[model samples]
Target: MQSSSSYPEAVEQLIAGFRRLPGVGARTAERLALAVLRWTPEELHDFGLLLATLPERVGECRVCGNLAEDDLCPVCRDPARDQSIICVVENADQVPVIERSGGHRGLYHVLGGRIVPLDGIGPEDLRIGELRARLDSGEVRELVLATGSDIEGEATATYLARELRRPGLAITRIATGIPVGADLAFADSATLATALNSRRPVG
Candidate 1:
């Protein structure tokens, strides 16, 4: 196809890079690239360095699979956190959302992603074995399913609840304060707190 872009090739390349970011549409990406052009060379260099070194600076938490600067995340390393309660979430992003709510002081378990068969995602695709290993230690007394309210999230929670159910293990699901089909990552702090506080037994 013939090129329709009026801007220089460098500007188009920068815009294309911005478009790769989530929620950055064509116009928004172009705007962002133009905004970057307004920045000082030093500032742009710093920004590029930050992005380039991000992988080396941050890694997945060895314990909960959340983003971390070290092998263990801050939460996992905290002695004051209640290790007896493990609030299960779909991804690392949801961890900060729940933390910001200030309702949960328990440990976390990141499932990586929810079970969506239509997308070729299943229980086997998740970190279910690692979660089971956590439970095997007998330190966790409760398993709170704090996954999203969406179909795939609900299905993942149901499957987990059944698989992890055992005597003395209190399995529960967060309340429906979040709207249906909404992700926990997008929930407000207050709403997330209410949902966490009102969580009920799942099985």
Candidate 2:
């Protein structure tokens, strides 16, 4: 008995698409497909339009490499944000994680990714040049490394510390609380706050 034969090809395709999303398993994908099937045609149409327009509407911020609708992200555009400090994160999503903690009041620089040697990703592959340019402007006084505690994150932080050491600039890494091998995206608000509050200088 072929279990998938009961559903139409389109329904199976929808389930497959849902499965492609991060952390979504086959059972959850099937449930999501069923839920979508139950939605009104208008709602489904609106969702389709949202998905279709996403790529065109969303663009990377030229300054910090974060997601934005225009040239600069909201953080970069905000006048009240502390321009003297910059929090460096591995991904755009981690920005919100730190923001919700309410421990940081500065600007952000998304690295796009960490340095992974085995995967052939290096510092040059990231947005390091852009970050350096921002620092060279003499406006930034401090940098907080909020990358994950994984090996790649560690290597990226170490490389950045060495390359970004300047006379007036202070470099620090988020202290322990976020366990080793864990991504900042998964850390809770309180834990993230503690890490930020206890950040120590990077050697």
Candidate 3:
């Protein structure tokens, strides 16, 4: 498995590590390993430092649960944004996709993940409690469930809709047929905007 002429063990270990990443096969991992080996000493050191410090440098926002360097994410802290409306998403990765659409001016709540019974993920495993707390604050007027159209996403939406139902609060689910199970990160801005604009009431 050692393809490198020099430091075979180190190169193979690096390749194996890369291979563990999603969508990265052995061939791609080998190529990445070779690329790293070819980098200058300073470049390699910088890259290593970035990887090592990334976790410590970035953390989830306490309010919205999005990746942030400070207590609150930019979206949550933005005064111009409509705090009365909250868009609920499955993860931080989906935030940029909805932002790119420029259709939503409300705040956001990241669930961290969806409900997947098969994978042993339940409503309690997500940020459902925090969402309920936010809803109880009486500040939010509408909760847009922007979760994916997949089974797990749907289940999560249903759970939230049922749990959060109350007077003076509007619960809506994003329009469907956006290539079910597809990650919102890959959806085009236009499509995402349309979906948000056409969201339907749930529960």
Candidate 4:
């Protein structure tokens, strides 16, 4: 995409950077760049600084692998949360959806991503080791697999169920037929609540 006459080389570079974002095409990138160019110098500078510092300022929780500003995320550190029951999710973003359903009071373990062989993601690449360590501690009584109902999500859940089965621990997968191929984060509260209530034991 050629730059407009009004846009300088530096502005074009910024637009190209924005274009690298997911679902952003050249036209959308130009729009975003123009919007930023319209901002006050102070606002633009602050926004740039925030973006620059994000990588260093945020990290995964040591225990649950969720995005965290500190050593552990709020859910992992909260005393009110039930530690005996753990909800295993594909990513941190899905956490709020389960919380909103008001059906789960347990802590969470973010797998970072599912096992998608086509994408070259494997079980070892995720946080499955940490989950096993948590279960080995014998404190957890139940594991609710909240991965999506898509092909990759199903594969991930099946792998986890086989890997995490133990004498004292009960493993279950969330009920499907809610929104196949969609993420748990996008499911409505009622659907998510029903799925949670109808979770089935997974061997």
**Can you tell me which runs of candidate 1 are displaced by over 4 Å?**
1-4, 180-182
How close is every model to the real structure, measured as TM-score?
0.88, 0.92, 0.87, 0.84
lDDT of 3 by residue, 21-43 (tens): 98998789988988888899999
Residues 39-59 of candidate 1: C-alpha lDDT, one tens digit per residue: 999999999999999989999
Any idea how many clashes model 4 has?
0
Best by TM-score: 2
Candidate 3 C-alpha error for residue 41, in Å: 2.2
TM-score of 3: 0.87
Candidate 2's TM-score reads 0.92
Regarding TM-score, does 1 or 2 come out ahead?
2
Error of 1 at 61 (Å): 1.0
Which residues of candidate 4, in runs, are more than 4 Å off? Answer: 2-5, 23-27, 117-121, 178-182
Better of 3 and 4 by TM-score: 3
Residue 91, candidate 1: Cα error in Å is 1.2
Off by over 4 Å in 3: 2-7
lDDT of 3 at 194: 94
lDDT of 4 at 183: 54
Q: Least lDDT summed over 10 consecutive residues: which range in candidate 2?
A: 176-185
